[model samples]
Target chain A: MAVAHAANDYRLGAQAVADGVYVFSGRNEHFTRDNGGNIVNTGFIVGTDAVIVIDTGPSLQYGEQQRKAIAAITRVPVRQVYVTHQHPDHYLGDAAYADASIAALPATISAIQTQGNALADNLYRLVGGWMAGTQSQSPTSTATPGVVEIGGRKLRLIGTAGHTAGDLMVYDEASRTLFAGDLVFHDRAPTTPNADLLQWLNALDQIRQIDFKVLVPGHGAVVRDASAIEQTRDYLQWLSTSLHTAAEQGRDMVEVMNQPLPERFQKLAVHDEEYRRSVSHLYPAIELTTLPRR
Target chain B: MSRARAALLVCALWCAGSLPAHAATAVDTPVDPLNSPSWQYMRQRFLGKDPMVFDARVQVQMPSAAEDQMQVPVHVSAPGLTDVVDVLVFADLNPLPKILRYQPTSAAPDIGFRFKVEQSTPVRAAMRTRDGVWHVGGAWLRASGGGCTAPSVGTGQGFWQDRLGEISARLWPQQPGLERLRLRMIHPMDTGLAAGIPVFHIDRIDMRASDGRLLASLQTYEPVSENPVISVDLQHSGPVRIDAHDIQGNRFAATVTP
Candidate 1:
């Protein structure tokens, strides 16, 4: 069990899920520097020969401190750093791990290169000095999706699209641990800024079939069963239905935004706020698809 | 660090060094250094050292966050400006943020319209209320970011292509002798915020009679939104026409007849 960290602690306590498998669990909360920008859960697999780090956090400070956390565990050289998605919190710290060969999808790489600086600038404004010395860094390698053998562990690469244009989930055959990047937000509200809800629903189905003992989500606590993925799907479906119905009814954005949050999402941190922001980001695309040309 | 990162770091340092120099000068100066050069040139061309007062009486009502950065609703009104002579609107972050140079014909002129807000920026409205005192009111609208630089998300490719210089206008008599003229021109209004997206926006517009009697000639900057919408209340209604052109030398003209 991971020790409950007080707010403002940058030091991470890696919780052991199984033999040689550990996760640096982030606070199931919003992105704040006091929490060390630990708004996303990242994983590392220590093998006999090497270590593979998953999803570096938001900034240079985070990457540097996370490196220290890794040092406390095993000194196995980090073979590759997989940036699971395009969001600033996931890939902006690739610069901090400049030594490691950063790997991401070719599309995600392009996105990070094109929109990365703007994302960094936005994060700088959002988190202030937490982004200091951290500039945008695109991935170093666009490795093809396949089974990546790190030391002796077999990581079956699963490519899923929905939460973003490219979402990567690695399932370790040996450990039965699934590293589900922003695809599953566990208990917290999943972000849908660039989501295709239909595809997101489909992606959840793919995640469900994977027989994994431990499921590490991008933003929340480790999932023990399929309930977390189902919760995410339910939220996405509700959001999609709400947006589609509002568009069909010719309801304006203000009216759609004021719609009360469903009882299911009430338990998530920042659920009300994320729902409001999601409505702003995703509603227009939904409206565009449904509305006839003027 | 690579050579590129090192050079970037040097440039970052130089920018940081110059920021404090500009920071002290910008206390209530209503200026963003990144967009200062164009602002200075525009200031020299438009109003030079005019006495400007920061006033709260003049209400500049605008959204806190623009759902669509391309079309931000802005309403500027001075309730008791019976002798209003001039009004100006501008944004600090736009390439040529100076949106309007208005000479209101009505003694009590109120503007309620929508325009582009490129980034999270202050939309300033300056009014000259006959006394020659320029009362400036401003409201900061949090943008989705990159209005001027982003292509129209509502339209597909070739959406603005061949559609440039296209003018749509409606001139109708509303109140006996008064006429309401609303003009919309199709343009991307790119603010140069998006990568590889250059600044392309309608630079100027003139609403006039067919005989060349100018009703209003608005000198605009880059943050004028895509498909710029302008409405003017005219004291007289007759054969009216509008001549508009972007910075790219695309010309459009539309005439509304009785």
Candidate 2:
């Protein structure tokens, strides 16, 4: 069993999930809205000699901080840093961990490079000093898959498209730890702006087949039960099916969002406040239900 | 010159005088930006949820067309002084109705500013006088879509902080006594629409005066630009400080010398 500590601070923590697998928490702090709050990037540090980082945080400064934390655990040189997907927070920090061979799916690399800088410029202007000068620095490795490694070992990148194009999750067989990136959310509702419901549900099915005991999601706390994955999958299944029906019934996006989640999965944690954004993004993807655009 | 030639020359002058300005020779119909539901709600409310302020007499000036919807610059100003109490600009059918709202607290009645236009939509600006009345003016702007869907620019991660200048107070006057000045800063009034690596949006922004007094507060949407720059006329001279805080507790402050 992984030891639980309140530590007061949300950013700092470490727990051994299995014999050789250790999970470290990240800074989950972010902006609050009229509805709820946003989940910032918090990744896991895996392995000893040949360490693999799950997801890089938001900026170069944050990336450096993540590296500093990983170094404290083990002095092993990081062999590879695998980004969960190509969002600014998860991948932009690639610069700080520049020495490590950065690896992610080709699509993720494209999303980061093509729209990365422009997005960063817009955010920097809005947040101002909160940007920490990360705005001015150019994105280090955009759309370039430096070290491409496909499915292997205790960890394998499973394709999940409901969240974003080229969204992938790392499955750890030894520890049964699925670093489900943004694929699974513990408490907060998942953002599906770039998602496809049908493909997302199928990805969930694929994730279910993995023999894992604990699931550490892209957002929220570490979920130690395999059922949590099933629950999230089921939620997506219900949402996708119901939303499709609703769309067919000529229901608007807001009505679809207002529609409550399945009572059975209500106990399963999801960020309900983020539903509007999810509906806005997923509706388009679901409405276009054909083949995966990517 | 002969009498016939003189008569012909007079006719030519009359024709020239009767014609409009070279640029005004052609007037193209404006496009509407609020085609989507999200944007439609925004434009309707901006004009005044009630009695709908419409700028009927004022002339609306915009480039007959625009290429970039993301950074399409919009300027709204009236040439003559009339019975104008307040001026509210609307990007008709934009997600937000009141794109720009101005009430003249100064001697000058003319007002001007810029905003991020969401789509190829009609942009309207209205002016209301001190007598509790409202007037409006409008133009069409051609903008691209997916600005709200577009990811936020810059580091959309971590707890970053900085200061921003205020439009109402952070103005440097060449002379003293309530200078009508314009100040702008970059910002993304994320409408909680765009999805980041971690799915979320920047929701709230709070602005305050140098002494930490309230100046202006606004709730933004994805319809606003990735980086939103707001311009406002101010009545102050000297070193003024402005602080802006986002919903994430990210704070920015700045000081300007007039």
Candidate 3:
């Protein structure tokens, strides 16, 4: 069925979040054949002489479609592509930017090199025919944490962890717009497959100090305020505290998973599924600590 | 009578005299059967030709699909079956079929643990009562596969090096005169299927009272998840001393009080 819809068009549209900065906000859903894994946010900044792309979508087709969307807006060639993290959804489309100098943090680059293929394979199984020729491509260069001017545009690359082992956030100095990767989920439930909750909270604290006019989260709608960051922090704190309490009580994994969610998080998209997945990922480690070593 | 008819009559008489009285009744087949390509072979290999029945009293609980294949939670309990001598848990389609063998010596025949599932398979729990009848219970679990073959996250990240052999435990009252002891240890439990990693896992564990009375014993295999955590119900509400050893001769011991 997915192959029959091989010509599936993402119909991606670029929304202007700031001057010369545009974001293609994806749907708040998981990977499926119908969505073609187009459930991640990606964007590009049009500089005076060139364009800088931030994070690619899932699958080669999505990336190609994103390039086309950018082309319709500006004729500026994409000079640099920044991969935010090692998550398959963010970096699996690296193959589309073969001509550009695709880059990520050093750790992220290594993770992509080591685990990218496996992650891509998993996505293929989840979305099926959408991943026809998509291949995991490691970043061609390393992105350090500092400001770098290119094509008359000043951009700052912030290197942080917690959402993953390596997460890179892009900040445009002129427009004062911050592209926060999976580190901040707005209305959607945050995924925690490789999360370090404490580290994530610390990273959020760091992000909160930044002065930005527009905040583009990795998922969900763009916001002008810090509500997304605060919401994410609150949900993560609740999740951490609840899991700690359950582990301290010596509750089994199944019981912890079946526990009712807070009424507030019930409104989040895919909250139940993401919460169960988080339990499976974080419960074992928490349980190991709650019961003291003898 | 002819020679052939006389011989056949003698054989029938011998078979009737040797068969047990319960054998007169037909053994009930499993309602769902948990049909798999490897079912017949695995059943014959594990249960042998012994008298067995698919009993509802033996409860095997697991999620319909594994959220994490590396650590699928499974709980097997036969509270209604008294004097359960041996309990065997296995996955029919797993490359390594046997999961663990649990002996509830002085404890209730109830266990909670985690294991790795290689693929979609029927996980079965067969408890042998004192009468030599094996009561079987099972559930079909769907997984994305590659659990046992994939290297453990902790091991790959070197998180278990310094913490190896560390034991953590807790005990609490579950019901009237019954206490539950939950414990975990740090180990990789690699299945040798992964590249460059050798076979390594905790092979055996013995739970006893502080005064040296055996409560239960468990023999685990590579299919057991990393840093194995297990909960067992005991009749006594007192301190429990757990002793365990891995295939590599590493020993660990801990004592916990309710």
Candidate 4:
């Protein structure tokens, strides 16, 4: 049961799906101040002696709100915060939990250190003043890919470089819910700014092989079945093949971007926007690869 | 009344001498509204109250939208024509819009140039013929500016120091009288977008004849790709010299003869 909290300070409706796992799902929209930078799924698992926060939201404001909401739900000590990836939406909020042991993949932490400030500047540019005091904070810990035990709870941390270089996924044995960071966007359109589509396909196959009843994605609504994973896989494959074929045929970027979207993915949120961005991001490199060496 | 009649007589004589013998007017609808304003302003600024109709006689080939705001490729070409005097290139929305004024020395017929752009605007080539009529041609390109204020991607960690001040310029006849002059220099047109990387770029170029008589000159800003190489049509190639400088006032010069 989600214990009621102060609506004004923490309005996130934490839904308890299993015995001790509660998730606060963000809206299927771009980061905006009105939404308070809550554009990703944040989950907290209540262990016997501590709480595990999975993927803090985008800003300190969102992280603080999530922390208060979790405190309202349980009195357990929030032991560790696992950042799913280097994307600002998933890790910038760790600033609010400065005292907590925040852990992320080694590559993810490095990215935050090198390109993190640039990403923070972009976040402010895209979304207005909602991130007034928000900034990227380096993770305090590196959670290697293995079984992490906290407060008698056994959680599996799997590392995959799919959507980004340091994409992370966490699975709970007790709840059977997989926190598939940016690897899966569920019903929403998956962003591929730093995607390796071929590896992303392999990552999806890995997710399919995992034993999980609930899939909490970083961007969209939580899924109860593996169909969402398959849908995302299909979308990635289709767009990649389409662009690859276009490149082989000597089609320019403008022509490739105007190619019709696959019928199956026509209804995806931000389909056009993401499709345009993906074409711009991948086509130039793909074209260079196809060109004759100097 | 006597003064007014004399002015009318002068105007008629001038119109008679100025009108083309056979005017094949090129008609094209204005670009989209958000974009049309810049090009319109450019034409008004250059053409004054009268805007010339476009003609394929002078064709401009440019990317519809630039992937890299800096280092945009532009090519202008026209078939062999004796009336061709010079070609002027400009980007309607660039901070310094007038990019090139190509005065063919040996009667150049082909030109290819590149520069930086700030936003979506028309990349135009206006060819002035012997009759003093401008035949316009253009292509629309969109850009996310900051080329002038962004750091050079390839110049990090003091790499630009090794190649700075190097100049490479050459010219050759495309066939006979038509020639191509390509003048390139080593410099990073840093746009100043990155933290701590200041705006560094070659901002001006003066093309002079063997006698140092100005053939063409233009003001450039960042968004012009790192290591700017400008190719233009040239007719008179008698020890032609070019002098250029960046925002920091670092001077570079080169002379080539064919």
Candidate 5:
């Protein structure tokens, strides 16, 4: 199906969550040709001399469109782009940020180098023509954890794992805005194709201690408080516990996929699809652990 | 059998018998039944010239939509057929279409396992009865495709290497005379379709009782999911031993007690 040129454009708009901190909140849905694979939240922080992009969008067109949107707000050229993790949606747009220094955690960089192409291929199949010009782009540099000052603005990068092998959360010291990356998804069900639920819960605990006024999740609308983190943690905990219980009871994958979700998660976007995907991603290992050895 | 049921059976047998002679090419003919586009070719390849019918007695269960294309769960059972000699399972549109050949020598004909679907296709399970007739059954599965070519998540990180050949199994008591054996093996059933990765997958699994009587055997293919998990119900069980091997010549053995 051919998308109209008008609909092809992401039409990304920057919503200011805090002073000089703008978030391009994405649709709370899975990747599709209609959405142009723009099912991720990417943001930029405008500093006096330069701008720091939190994460890139899904494709080259998205990244270019995002760059134009950022320019509409500030002429400060993007000095650095921080990829939150190795997931395709977050990094496939790195090609458009060729002028800026793209950085990620070491593990995430390695993952991108190895599995990025495969992940990109999967997305191309899922999102169809929207992923036409998209390709996997490796990070240009390693993002070391800790505070770094650029253009008179200080940002703290917290290196953690759980969502994937490496998740980088950027904290804007000036605006007290924490770009929680995929570590904290608000109103959107978390994707666990490469997740360690226990580690993800620990990462959430780490995020809980961060002193930030505004939290910019990797997806969904920007939030102000710890509710988003709590939501992610609660959902992950319930998912882990339910999978383990299912394994202990000798339930098959199909049965586990069909398990009823808690009422609280009924409102979460893509809950059914994400839950089934998570079961396929994690049930085998859980089953291995729960099965008896005689 | 009832008069009408026996007559319908005879008609089905006659139709199946006349398929090869007639060389039927129709998509929905009784001989070339099932909604799959590749049923005719698959029937000829797997069942050869044997008489076959789309029998409701052979039940094949698969999700209508494959949430994870790389690991779609499937279950097949022919409880109504008593003298089933062999069961063949396959996907019609997969690049690697043949999935497995299961022989329920001493175990029940029911089995549950996982496999990969490259795209939206019909997955079929055909059971051979004592009369050499193939009872076919299947369901159409919708998927985004690319399951076989994509490298497994565990393989890139070397996660499966350390736990390779490790088998975890359990025997659960069911009803009075039956027992369910659920087992999982740690191996990335790589299809060799991905770049830089060779095809390495478990190809054979034999289940035996403690007394050395062979219960069931399954010959699998690369389309089987990584770290395959299978459940089989046994007619008689105390302790069941599982002997398996992959394409790389690695052998794994495990035993579970009831």
Candidate 6:
């Protein structure tokens, strides 16, 4: 799960994710795991008519790389760049694809406006020199999704928060490929701050309801079946359940982590160090005895 | 006699001119090493020197207030004192007090890295010599805080059972015998970021030569990014064997011949 290596490898390769959908994975070599998603920015070339770019990537340099990837396919005027979320990695590079109406959920736009500057500053410091071509400012003040389109080409934009307050999953009907933005993890666990464990399970259920042939994770390799999604869902559910049980029992956080989790989960990318924190966040939410009833 | 008296007068005059208006007389204060705040655990746990005298001039670069403490970038530099052998970073407030320890083969005194800061607390970087004389510096950083309990960065659980072995050393020899060894592993490095998951941490990584001699050994923590990329200076004089083990002794070993 060396995300840094992934970012540096796929700068401008027009690798196909689905039939028409092409993912332009950005350079992977970086200090930290630039959690924008392994796929630098995703998009598709629709015949000779127009090309719709999915996400713009983290910075201006990333945008340039995504553009070059698009150029390899078709010179068609880039009509629209659909941003999956408000996270800077998905939307900050919007300026690079100028003239294309930057599209996103209204909620994402608001989240960007609210925390863009602060997020940029925080990320810039963490990334150091890797943020060379990124937007100088977070664009928090000015970033408003110019053309907010909901569903496109049978690909539904599902509001899946918890990972972040404003996360959306793009479901392509034709390809049955769900571009899960930090929602699914094939190799590692998803980082969740605004994590509503229950809401996340519900969201996973929604994702499951859809019949998808392939699941394109926000990071890692593409998942080809529902089983992958199930693994992720089960992991979150188990964590919630375990944390809930601990909180219900009035157990000490440290003591709970010291106790081994389910053997099924030991191999799952859960960090031992983070056990206490996970318990703290989920303990309150899981304290509700009516989870099973819900 | 006369010459010594003249020198003393000249020194006194120079001090008077250089002194600030509110300068207080320099007092010979008792040095109580117990009062100084350094990670005693790191000193006792790791094989390092003790009674380290901390210097105040060397300050670390960190935000006054960070919005996100998940991956806070920190830079520590020792401008002078080339004789120092290594500088180790330790945080008093973090769950893992020892953040990173750099044993530099080169002459570079400055080392910068991106790591997760748990909370608003003082971070100390102690530099020690071959003779075990430790010189220390520290700084207070106000991070957004949430490392001890932050969620895992991965999507699901752990590394794929298939990919677990892939976590090994990938060595590319720039020239003959001298190789640039990039050893990567699939580790979650769960810095107590999230809730529910149990404690699973890789405590020590011993990188040794084939002849049973040690090249470099790291006492790691959850703060190190997942699948920590450790680049070691390998001379390729002998075959290499790197054995990395978690706190639970789940050993992942790799071998390479540069």
Backbone clashes under 3 angstroms, per model: 3, 67, 0, 16, 0, 42
iRMSD (Å), candidate 6: 18.4
Most accurate candidate by TM-score: 3
Candidate 3 docks with a DockQ of 0.44
TM-scores for chain B, in order? Answer: 0.70, 0.57, 0.87, 0.67, 0.89, 0.61
| Ten residues in sequence with the least summed lDDT for candidate 4 chain A | A1-10
> Order of candidates by lDDT, top first?
3, 5, 4, 1, 6, 2
CA lDDT, candidate 2, residue A11:
49
Alpha-carbon runs more than 4 Å astray in model 2: A1-11, A26-41, A44-48, A122-130, A135-154, A255-272, A284-294, B1-258
lDDT of 6 by residue, A115-195 (tens): 777666666766554455566322222224222332245556676566666666666666776777766665445445557
Task: Provide the fnat value for model 1, as a fraction from 0 to 1.
Answer: 0.02
On lDDT, the leading prediction is 3
Tell me the native contact fraction for each prediction: 0.02, 0.00, 0.53, 0.00, 0.42, 0.00
Native-to-model Cα distance after best TM-score fit, residue A231 in candidate 6, in Å = 1.4
Candidate 1 off by > 4 Å: A1-9, B1-115, B118-140, B143-158, B162-186, B189-224, B227-258
Question: What does candidate 1 score on TM?
Answer: 0.64
Worst 10 residues of 3 chain A by lDDT: A1-10
Model 3 spans with C-alpha error above 4 angstroms: A1-6, B1-28, B48-68, B77-86, B128-135, B150-166, B174-176, B186-201, B245-252
In terms of docking quality, model 3 is acceptable
User: What lDDT tens digits, residue by residue, belong to model 3 across residues A151-185?
Assistant: 78999999999999999999999999999999999
**Candidate 2 chain B: 10-residue stretch with minimal lDDT:** B25-34
Q: Which candidate gets the maximum DockQ versus the true structure?
A: 3
Instruction: Write the residue-wise lDDT of candidate 5 on B1-258 in tens digits.
Output: 243245447547666657666535323335334457777788778877666777767777766788778889988887667889899999999999999999988778878899888999888888988776677777778997689999988898899889898888888877776788898888989999999999889999999988889999999899998888898888875889899998878999988887
TM-score of 3: 0.86
Candidate 1, A55-170: lDDT as tens digits:
88888777766777887999887778888889988877677677788888877888887899987887776667667688888799985678989888888888878998988888
- Can you rank all candidates by TM-score, best first? 3, 5, 4, 1, 6, 2
